[model samples]
Target: MRDIMGMMGKVKEMQAKMEKMQEEIAALEVEGKSGGGLVTVVMTGKGELKSVKIDPALFKDDDVEILEDLLVAAHKDAKDKVEAVAAEKTKAMTAGLPIPPGFKLPF
Candidate 1:
């Protein structure tokens, strides 16, 4: 049927768009900071940690626990940002699609 053929065409187009979006997301970098910028983390949109930075002031032996906490917080913040970016990209890619309400794409 013509309708079925049209839907298939749309599906192919969506697939191409999704692949492009994935590549773009993988190339994105996000930064997150914690402890008043004493610690910072950089992560890719796929949630892979790219790097971490810590202020020299937090390098004292007695502040090991504090440094650890800051690192964790910074990493979490970066990951959250990455997730938000991915969500935004997905929303834009799926706009105007006939997906049902409350249906979430399995990413």
Candidate 2:
């Protein structure tokens, strides 16, 4: 039964690591920009938008639609970056665990 006990210990250790990783990810902040750096957004690893910035030069009435589009693009960029960060962290945490390729986390 030593093997089972050792496995249990490892499982507990992995659980603690996963908890810490989740905390770190929740505290992560990332920025994404678009439209020649005219638009930018900051987001947390949880996909929550924290802030947005747009260059004042895009204030023209005709550029409203363009500005809107840039805002959307910037948000998408930020969300993608957040996902990448979370995925990288999860991958690192699960390294050599023999998890299925398509498995999801949060166990």
Candidate 3:
């Protein structure tokens, strides 16, 4: 049962590390831009939208649809960045662990 006990200890340690990582991720902010920086979005690592910025010049344009599209693109960019950051941090946190390759944590 020693092996099992050791494994359990490792699991507990990993859990703590994961919790800390989650908090770190929640505190991170990433910025994304679109339409040659005319539209920008800020999002937390958890993919929550934090804020949006639009160039004043875009207001001079009459096509609202284009502005809408740019906003969507910018939000998507921010979301992608957030995912990238999460992946990076997770990789760091999992380094040297016994987890099988391609296995995801936190179920």
Instruction: Write the residue-wise lDDT of candidate 3 on 6-107 in tens digits.
Output: 999998998998899899988889999999999999998878888999999988868899999999999999988877888888999888867798777662
TM-scores of the models, in the order given: 0.90, 0.91, 0.89
lDDT of 2 by residue, 1-103 (tens): 9999999999999999999988898888999899989999999878789999988888866668888899999989888887888899899889999999988
Question: Residue 11 CA error for candidate 2 (Å)?
Answer: 0.9
Ten-residue region with minimum lDDT total, candidate 3: 98-107
Ranking of candidates on TM-score, top first: 2, 1, 3
lDDT of 1 by residue, 53-80 (tens): 9899876677688888999999999988
Candidate 1 yields a Cα-based lDDT of 0.88
Misplaced by over 4 Å in model 1 are: 100-102
The runs of at least 3 residues in candidate 2 whose Cα sits more than 4 Å from the true structure, single-residue gaps closed, are none
User: How much does candidate 1 score in TM-score?
Assistant: 0.90
